[model samples]
Target: MKFADIGLSDELLRAIDESGYNEATPIQAGVIPSVLMMRDIIGIAQTGTGKTASFVLPMIDILAHGRARALMPRSLILAPTRELAAQVAENFEKYGKYHKLSMALLIGGVQMGDQVKALEKGVDVLIATPGRLMDLFERGKILLTGCNLLVIDEADRMLDMGFIPDIENICTKLPATRQTLLFSATMPAPIKRLADKFLSNPKTIEVARPASRNENIEQFLVKTSERGKRDTLRSLIEAEDIKTAIIFCNRKTTVRELAKSLQRYGYKAGEIQGDMDQSSRTAELDRFKAGTINILVASDVAARGLDVKGVSHVFNFDAPWHPDDYVHRIGRTGRAGAQGRAFTLVTPSDDEAIDNIQKLTGYKIPVHGGGAPAVDVAQPDRDEAEAEPRRGRSARGGRGKAAAKAEKAPARPAPVAEARPAKPREDRKPRNDRKPAPRHDDLDGPDDGWNGPMPGFLSVGFDT
Candidate 1:
């Protein structure tokens, strides 16, 4: 259905059109109408399904008539990560340009002075991560008692980040008569219990089955060794015509290192991790979004609620530890019905992890690129690992003592020999008269095989 038919204001519709969106996504189409009717909603849809707009669009319309009081926002939206919270704020800015709604973003890694100022002026909407919001609430910079509309977005992600207790605390601080909308990609029991305890009788909407793969995304897995993961990722990037892509790593250090490696190879790559300050993270993301950087190396922090359009490929540099993260990482691509590709680099050690992902998704990911795999070392199964060969002294058995004794046995005297004058009728020149051999690059013919000098990355304090 069209955005115009959903009872949105002309201003909101104009902003939508300017953003080049006319028809709503399945999730948006399902939740927009219900949200406009002031009903609590439990939306079950995966990431990248336009779920952000599902709430943001209607929240604008619902909050248009209200004036926020000092220290009290009219509506509250909670996200699981800083990146997700910032993205939500961007959406509000883009969609609410025609309206005069004031919004504040509360996230970690940033100073609270400006946030306190925004709260003092009051706001129509407050988007925040759980940790930062509570910090502000404790300092008496903001008040949640007046917030009548509450949205706990990415609820399942909250549970993963260990934010459920914080969520429960925040829920208690809000007025009991407020409307709560909880949205998630999967409905795990923890999230279900939270919903049952917090949300009043709500309208439930499931746009797609839980953990269901998107038909628009083509998935492939590559079996490679741990040492070859970088090489495999490079090969895939060259093989695919990726307009823009995100490379997921399980650790923050991996994210930083992979991004540096890509940069050394002359790719426009950037890195984002929890260790970076808020300003640096913002700058890197802005560069990525503005096309200055084409590749982003990130951890699971970006797995949920980040919406960047035209991501043609996603490379899992490291297999995710959690099965659900596999869905979120790949979901970054193939968004809004756009056809995309996702390639995962699996190593021998990742066998069990990948298997768990397949089990959760209920399908085997297809193998692609016929040839020697990027990583040839297949990890041994449990049984093989248990039967591993003995090592060192254990493997020597009874011969180790004799071998040590033989090494210390006295050596026989050498047979006397008269040194004979060497005959020098060979092609070798006299040592003093011979010049240095030609360097590899100076040799002639294609057989000489001259590539440029090595990058000297190791000398520069980086890994080769």
Candidate 2:
């Protein structure tokens, strides 16, 4: 159904139209009406299912009449990560443009003074990470009792990040009767327990099974040794003609290394990991979205709620540690019902992880023998996958300047015969029976010759 049918304001509809969305996604359709009716909600959907707009769109209308009071935001939305919080803030800006709703984003790595100032002036909406929000709350900079609308986005991620206690604390601080909406990709037992304790007779909406694979994405697992992951990824990139992709590594160092390696091999690659400050991470994301870089090598921190358009491929450089992470990693692509492809590089040791991922998602990803990259055919990398991929230049039969140089550069001149051969061992005397050099005391008294044990000078000082 259309967004208008969901009872959104004309201003919101205009904003939606301007953003080129006419039809409401299933989650938006299902959750928006319930949210508008002031009902608490528990929304269960996989990542990239338009969960942000599901709440943001309706809240604009719900919040239009409220004037925020000092130190008390009218509404609160909690995100697990700074990036997700920022994304939600951006959505508020996009959808709330017609309404003059003031919003403040509270996240770490940014100056608290600015956030405090925003809170002092009051805001219609406060989008925040739990840690930052709790910090401000304890500092007496912000109050939650007056906030009527609460959204907990990516609840499972919050649980995974050990934010549930903070979440529970924030919940206790908020007015008990206030409306709360909790959205999550998967409902682990702990998350379910949190929901049971917090949400009050909420309207339950499940558009898709938790951790279920998106049918729009074609998934594959490529079997390779640990060391062959990079080459396998390169081969897949060549074979699949990946236009834009995010490569997921298990560790922050791996993220940095993979991005650098891809760049060295002539791909326009960038990295975002937890090690980076929030600003740097945001900047890298901006670069990726702006197409300044076509390939983003990232950690699971970017696996959830990072929405970039038209990403055609996702490569998992390492299998995710958590079964739920696999869902979010691939969810970065095949977004908004767009058909996409994902390839997971599976090593022998990843058997259990892969099994868990498939079991969690309730589907087996097809196996790709490294995409059968044609030895004689090579596809040119586009945008940041630039120059020619290393595989294409070498084994894949693509001749570029680098390849030409490789062909033209002469092989090493035959090693010069080790300067002078091992001078014959034959010239060496064996020490097996050689007597110790004669002591001065044992030698004939003062031999006159130069070869004497004591050259005459040694004996001459003592006895001559």
Candidate 3:
């Protein structure tokens, strides 16, 4: 449906048109009307389905006529990460440009002074991460009593980051009569409980099945050894027709290392991870969106709520530990009704992780090279068996060469041993009267005298 059919104001429709979107996405179409009517909402849709605009557009129109009081915001949007909060704030700016709605961003990795100042001046919309918002609230820098609309974006992510308690605390601080909206890619048990407790008889709108894969994305699992992952990834990047891509790693260190490796290989790559400051992360994301870097290596921080358009592919450098993450990571591509591809490098150790993803998504991902999955434990045994004959042949050749060299050399005299019986203790010499044993080094030449027959074990022979 078009934005005009969603009952948005003429000014908001104009902004939407200017933003090059006439029709509303599924989530947006299902949500904007409920939000405009001041009804509670529980929206479940995968990432990149325009979930941000569903609430942002309606909230702008709802707050356009309200007067924001000092230390209090007319609407509150709680995001899981600093990047996601900033993205939501950007959406507000982009879609609310035609209106005079004031906005304030409260997130970590930056000074709280500016945020406090913004609160003192009042804001129509306040976008924040749970931690930073809680920090400011504890210091009395902000107030939630005046907020009548509360949106908990990325609810499942909040649960994963252990921010549910903070969200509940924030909810208690707000007016009980407020209209709350909870949006997530999947409605897990905890997220469902959160919505049940906070939202009052909310209209649950699920555009697609929870954790469903986008049909526009062609997903493949690339089998690779742990040591061969980088080489395989480079080969894929070079072989595929990529416009832009995001490579996801489980750890921030991996993200940094992968990004550096890609750059060394002459690919325009950048990284964004939790260790980086907010400004640095924002700069890296800006570089990615502006095409300064065609590939972005990132941690789970960018797995959700990052809206970069025209991403042609997504490469899972490390299979995500959580099944939900696989969905979100791949969802980075195939966005906005665009066709894209996703390749996940699965090592032997990632069997469990890949299995969990397939189970969650209810479909097995096709193998990249058209063979069985790569997590076979017996492969090493087969490799060792194939190498055994070569090892045996090498050993035989070495022995033959040694035997030939020995045959060419002159034979040395064989030493003999006497078969004398043990002497009686009385006939033994005293310790002080005993002579020193002859040292082998004392003799200038090999002994020519034979004491007795040579021992059979002392003879050397080769395998003929």
Candidate 4:
């Protein structure tokens, strides 16, 4: 159905039209109505399912009449990462352009003074990451008591990043009677518990099974050694003809390393992690979106809430610890009604991890063995894998054949059996020259079975 069918304001409908989204995604269709009714909601859907608009549209309609007080927001949206918060803020601008709803973003890596100034100007909508929100609240820069609409987006990722505590803290500061909306791609027990704690009796909306991937994405897994992961990534970028893509790494360090490796290979690649300044990160993302940089190597921080268009591919250089993250990572592509592809490099040890990812996505990632990659095929480093240091060099020393032979000798030519086989056992005096071994009973207890019935003589005498 179209946005109008969901009873959105004309302004929002026009904004949706301008954005080129006439039909609402199943998630938006399911969620908007319940939200309009002012009922709390729990929305579970995969990424790229148009979840941001599901709540944003309804929020703009509800918040249209409210006037926010200085340093006090009328509605609050908490995201797990800065990119997502910024994305939400952009949505507010896009969908709320006709309405005079003011919004401010409170996220780290950005200028706090500007955010503070925005908060001072009074905001009808506030989008923030958990950490920065807490900092502002603690420092008296923003107040939550006036917030009437609460949204916890990407709840599963929040739990992954340990933001649940800050989320709970923010919840306590907000009005308990507020409308609460929680959305996630996957729901583990912890996320469920957090939802149960925050959301009142709520309308549950799920357009698809949790942790499932979009059919628009064609997924593949390439088995490669750790030494070849970078080469494979480079080749995948070149072979896939990736116009733009986000390369996911498990660690920030790996992200930097991979980004450097990509740059070294003459690819327009940049890195984004938690450490970079906000301007640098924003510039890199803008370059990516503007097509100046075709590749972005990032940690899980970029896994969610990033809405870059035309991401033709997603590369997972390291297997994510949570399979749910795999879904979010690939969701970056295959968006905006476009077909996208995702490639993952797997090592022998990642078999279980890759299996878990498949279990989460509801389909096995097709295995692509060495051949022309659907993307460019970069030659693998034949000696790299063997060159890296092995984990915990064996205490026994290197096991090369030469080393083994040097450490052992052909059974020392067994001395020829003495020609005097006539020697009898008696003639061979007691071979064991050591003292006689103690008897079993002497070492343990008396052989007599009845000894346990009475106190031992040694015990009675010692007592006396």
| Clash count per candidate | 3, 1, 0, 4
Candidates 2 and 4, the one with greater lDDT: 2
Task: Please provide, for model 1 over 1-464, each residue's C-alpha lDDT reduced to its tens digit, 9 standing for 90 to 100.
Answer: 99888899999999999999999989999999999989999999978889999999999999999799999999999999999999999999999999999999999999899999999999999999999999988888889999999999999899999999999999999999988899999999999999999999999999888888888899988878665567677778888898999999989978887888788789999988888998998899899899999999998888887788899999898889989999999999998889999999987788899899998888888887663474434332222232334323343453343454566788778899999988778967779997444454442433235353333332357458
Weakest 10 consecutive residues of candidate 4 by summed lDDT = 450-459
TM-score of each: 0.81, 0.82, 0.81, 0.80
Of candidate 2, the 10-residue stretch with the lowest lDDT total is 374-383
lDDT of 1 at 74: 92
The best candidate by TM-score is: 2
Pairs of colliding residues, candidate 2: 268-384
Q: What digit string (tens of lDDT, one per residue) describes model 4 on residues 234-313?
A: 66665667688888999987888678767767889998998888888888888888889888999888999799888999
Per-residue lDDT over 138-226 for candidate 2, one digit per residue giving the tens place of the 0 to 100 score: 88899888988899999999988999999999999899889999999988899889888998998889999888879899999887765
lDDT for every model? 0.87, 0.87, 0.88, 0.83
Error of 1 at 303 (Å): 1.2
CA error at residue 376 for candidate 2, angstroms: 14
For residue 266, give model 2's deviation from the true position in Å: 1.2
lDDT of 1 at 388: 35
Which pairs clash in the backbone of model 3? none
The weakest ten consecutive residues by lDDT in model 1 span: 378-387
